[model samples]
Target: MNVPELFEEGWYWTSTQYSPNLAWSQSFDDGLQGNLVKDYEGRVRVVRRFPLN
Candidate 1:
């Protein structure tokens, strides 16, 4: 299940914010969800949303 070609095994930040200084993050290595400080750097994927018209 470790597909390096698809995504690297590391923590990825999300748009969810726990506080002004904390945000949500997910671990690609173990599929765990948690929060982290906004000042810390992590991995992320480009996500785009489109409205249906």
Candidate 2:
């Protein structure tokens, strides 16, 4: 079964704060993760996890 199917080829923002000028980001298609300038505009993804315990 398909889950969370928002798989679009684009960059997304992450909560991992890098610095005053850059922030962490990730891609959905190519699986590229890196930092980009704070002024750069990209897609955002907010995720939540449930404990298996």
Candidate 3:
């Protein structure tokens, strides 16, 4: 897909995490899947998914 399409899909996924009406908690399941970690300033962050087995 093009960059714009990819960005829109990403935005949709991120927004779902903030939805209050979802049946389950929307926080990332770190234990179930590895994630892409980035260091911003002094803080470590997981901004994307890693390989899922």
Best by lDDT: 1
Candidate 1: C-alpha lDDT: 0.85
TM-score pick, better of 1 and 3: 1
- Residue-level lDDT tens digits of model 1 in 1-53: 33456778899998889999999999888989999999888988765676766
| Candidate 2 lDDT by residue in tens digits, 1-53 | 23547656788999888998899999887888999998998988667767664
lDDT, candidates in the order shown: 0.85, 0.83, 0.26
RMSD of 1: 4.7
Please give each candidate's TM-score: 0.72, 0.79, 0.14
The candidate with the higher TM-score, 1 or 2, is 2
Candidates' RMSD to native: 4.7, 2.3, 12.8
**Residue lDDT tens for model 3, 1-53:** 12332232211122222234332112232322222222211222335656765
Off by over 4 Å in 3: 5-11, 19-53
Q: What's the lDDT for residue 32 in model 3?
A: 26
Candidate that scores best on TM-score: 2
Query: By lDDT, highest first, what's the ranking?
Result: 1, 2, 3
After superposition, which runs of candidate 2 have C-alpha atoms over 4 Å from their true positions? 1-4
